[model samples]
Target: METTLTLKDVTITYDKKPALEQVSLSFPKNRITAVIGPSGCGKTTLLRAMNRMLEEEPGAAVEGQILLNGDDVQKLPPEELRRRVGLVFQTPAPFPFSIYKNMTFALRYYGVQNKERLDAVVREKLTLAGLYEEVKDRLDKSALKLSGGQQQRLCI
Candidate 1:
């Protein structure tokens, strides 16, 4: 199988402490790869670094390269990289916006300005996530009103 994501000598650290050191792996296309370990073993750090979410932390720093389909993630714009690799945090933090706006926030941030296109992408992503059909009629409703499971899929 072809490689879809590759990490070469990836290291992550918080403040002056080491989290991951010299970890390298290639994830094959069309397959699920799980990073399993005990707490504080850098599993979350590895995923965050792959999607460039490590930059969100004040003291978090990354080393080495994360390649998505042969393109270096560090070279790609952060917004673009995030769009390509969506992260669902362990916690769900719903924004104070309508379901439509909540779903399209990232699309708009990535410069998707066309209303029709935005609607289409939001519906498509939500449909793929198995959330749109449940909330389709209430697209204009506040997303905070959704049930826990619904909100989870929307966040995803």
Candidate 2:
């Protein structure tokens, strides 16, 4: 069996302050795992490092290997790695646009532009995120108008 994600002796530092230290873990393809810790215990830092999102933060640095399906994700393009390992933030960060536009933005950013295909993808993702029924009739409405939970689902 292959692992879906693996972190080997991973460490992250911010402004010379250590956020994560010497952590190793493996997530098997069909299994689920959770990280439970107090605040500032590096849970988010470790998660960000796995997908290399920490690289975007100022003065943030990571050490060691983050492998996705046997390939080093650090060696892959950030955009490509992000596609395979999407992250949903703790808070909703919807775009300042309509409900339809919110999903369309992700599709367009990934170079998906066909109308029918994009619509299908949006609907599919929204349905998977459990927001389809709530916004089915108002896809043209502003995403900001939604409740916090709904907006978070839209972002998912």
Candidate 3:
């Protein structure tokens, strides 16, 4: 099987303390790979490091290489890298905006300005996340008004 992401000798530290040390992993393309561990293990850290989110954490340090399709993640722009490597948080995090706006925020930031296209993309994404039918009529309502499960689905 082909690999989609690879981590080689990757280590992560926070405030001079290590969270992950010399870890290596590869996720196969089109395959489900689970990183199972006890709570507080480096699973989240490992995932964040893959897309360079680790760099956002204060005092966090990463070493070694993280490659996506053999391309170094460090070589890619943070926005482009994040677009390719999405990480859904364990908790729901809806933006403080309408459901439609929440869905279109990234699209707009990426220069999608056509209203029809934005609507279509919002509908498509909500549908894919199984949220369209639940909140389709309330697209202009605040996303935070949705139930926790609904908000999580929207986040996904």
Candidate 4:
């Protein structure tokens, strides 16, 4: 099996305190993998480090090689890497916008301007996240109006 993501000796630290110490992992392509652990076990930290979002923290540091399809994640532009690798936050965070707007915001940012394409992408993503059937008739409503579970799915 081919691995789509590989972490070699990855260590994450916050203000010199190690959150994740010398961890190595690999995720196989096309497979659904879960990071199972109790609370405060660095599961979210490990995930944030994968896509370089950990760097946003004031004192966070990551040392090691994170490769996405054999390319160093550090070498890739942050936006481009994030476009390729997305992270759904553990807490549901929907933008203060309509569900349709939330769905198309990134697509528009990436220059997908055609109405047909935007509509199709939104439908496809919502369907994949199992949210389309529930929210299809309410896409114009505020995303914040959704239930916690529904909001999280919309975040996908």
Best by TM-score: 3
- Model 3, global lDDT: 0.93
Top-lDDT candidate index: 4
Error of 1 at 16 (Å): 1.8
Per-model CA lDDT versus the true structure: 0.88, 0.88, 0.93, 0.93
Q: How many Å off is the CA of 110 in candidate 1?
A: 5.6
Candidate 1 per-residue lDDT, tens place, 1-156, comes to 799999999888889678899999999998988888888777878899988888989999999889999999989999888878877766677798999999888778879899999989888999998988898899999999998888888898
Task: Report the C-alpha lDDT of model 3 over 75-119, residue by residue, as the tens digit.
Answer: 999998998998887788999999999999988988999999999
The residue-by-residue lDDT of candidate 2 on 93-114, one tens digit each, is 8988999998898669879889
- Model 1's alpha-carbon lDDT is 0.88
Model 2 clashing residue pairs (backbone): none
Return the TM-score for candidate 4, rounded to 2 decimals: 0.93
Per-prediction TM-score: 0.82, 0.91, 0.94, 0.93
Which candidate do you rate higher for TM-score, 1 or 2?
A: 2
